[model samples]
Target chain A: EAGVAQSPRYKIIEKRQSVAFWCNPISGHATLYWYQQILGQGPKLLIQFQNNGVVDDSQLPKDRFSAERLKGVDSTLKIQPAKLEDSAVYLCASSLVGGSEQYFGPGTRLTVT
Target chain B: QQPVQSPQAVILREGEDAVINCSSSKALYSVHWYRQKHGEAPVFLMILLKGGEQKGHEKISASFNEKKQQSSLYLTASQLSYSGTYFCGTEGAGSYQLTFGKGTKLSVIP
Candidate 1:
């Protein structure tokens, strides 16, 4: 079985520029999540979607970050006017249902200079 | 909120054993473990559900104590492959988010 897939494995952009990351979850998974992992730190939950409807985004930086899972299969996470601190690995994961072990993607490494 | 992990870092010789703990203030319904190599996405290790159940792969085990709202990852007779940063992600009751602990870096020297 194929695992979670993500595109643009590495990215480099200047501060104040816009960047977007894409993710394709595992087949048949219903819950998708976006997480930001900084250097030397664990991935921090940014948003979660249950069948295209957000289940939790309390930690998302609304002013600069946005994500959507259209049709509940593929998802995109965008950051406009990126800041230096936004330079981190953006990971996408998916699970079976309400509670299950998540499968992670290779992650898109964003470098905001 | 993020969970707290103990022994921020540990160094072990081959064939030794080590334990990493993760504690959360909020009641957890499930605890997930992952091992990440430097610059790579974390790989799923195991998940321990509530009711004090333990589940894991060969040589790597974990225990979840619902009463204590904590979980521990155990690596027995460690090998070089066990060297990496270990993180515990916990899902609280009624919440979909899986808050992760900072991490525990383990170095197993041969």
Candidate 2:
């Protein structure tokens, strides 16, 4: 079976510019999540969605970051007015349920100069 | 809060044993174990829920001590394939977010 798919494996943007990443989860998966992994650090949850509804996004930077899971099959995460600190890998994952193991995509490595 | 992982890195000889520990400040609802090889996505190892006993997946065994809010990953007779970074993600009480540890890098030399 195909695993989770993400677009634009790598991205480079300037500070104050905007960037967006996309994800196509595994077939039939019901839960999707977005995470940020800074260099040499473990991934931190940014947001989570169960189908078309968001399940959690408490850690996301509401002032600059936003995400949506439209139609429950694909999702997008956007960051506006990017900061230098936003230069990290954006990972996308999906699972059958909130309690199940997640399958991750290749991730979009964003470099904000 | 983020979990604390012990021995930021470890180097083990093939067939040797190793243990990685994770401790949390807040109460944990469940602890999940994942292993990620360099440049690859993390693969799930096991999960130990609150009030649940120790759990084992293949040769990789994990124990969740709710009283201490700590969990440990045990690799017995380690193999070269065990080389990777191991991260422990804790599901905090009443929270859906998974606060992951900094991760422990394990290098198993054959």
Candidate 3:
């Protein structure tokens, strides 16, 4: 079975620049999530989607970050006007409905200089 | 809120036993554990559901105490391959997304 897939395993951008990351979740998975992991820390939920609609984004930085799941199959997370602190890994994960385990992608390591 | 993990780091010799704890202020419906090596994605270890019971997977087992909203991961006869960061992701009783703890860094030495 294929796991969640993400694009651009690594990205480098300057402060004030914008960056986008993509994710293609495991087929038939009904839930998708985006998380940010700063160095030496655990993953923090940035947003969650149930199919094509967002279920939770309360922790997302509204002014600078946004995410969307299209057609309930793929998702994208964007960070605009990146900051030095944004130099962390962006992880994507997916799971079956009501399932306890989540499959994670390789993640995109974004370095904002 | 993110769960809290105790003993930010632990170093143990191979064959020794170590324990990592994860506690949350909110009521937890489930607790999921994972291990991630440097520069790698987290690999699922085990999941403890409600009922406040203990679940064992391989040489690693976990206990969930609903009354205290805490979970603990036990590594017995630790192996050199056990070196990595362990994270506990908790699903609150009323929440959908899993909120992960800071993590416990474990280093099993030879």
Candidate 1 residues lying further than 4 Å off, grouped into runs, are none
The native-contact fractions of the candidates, in order shown, are: 0.79, 0.56, 0.72
lDDT of each: 0.93, 0.93, 0.92
Q: Which ten residues in a row have the lowest lDDT in candidate 3 chain B?
A: B92-101
Task: Report the C-alpha lDDT of model 1 over B2-110, residue by residue, as the tens digit.
Answer: 8999989999999999999999998999999999988778998998888999876889999999999999999999999999999999998878678899999999999
lDDT assessment of candidate 1: 0.93
Error at B25, model 3, angstroms: 1.6
Task: Provide C-alpha RMSD values for all models, in order.
Answer: 1.0, 1.2, 1.0
Better of 1 and 3 by lDDT: 1
lDDT of predicted model 3 = 0.92
The lDDT-based order of candidates, best leading, equals 1, 2, 3
The local lDDT score (0 to 100) that residue B103 gets in candidate 1 is 99
* DockQ of all models, two decimals each: 0.81, 0.69, 0.76
User: Which residue pairs show collisions in model 2?
Assistant: none
What's the C-alpha lDDT at position A37 in model 1? Answer: 95
Clashes of each: 0, 0, 0
After TM-score superposition, what is the CA distance of residue B68 in candidate 3 from its true location, in Å? 0.9
lDDT of 2 at A39: 82
Q: What DockQ class does candidate 2 belong to?
A: medium
Chain B TM-score by candidate, in order shown = 0.97, 0.97, 0.96
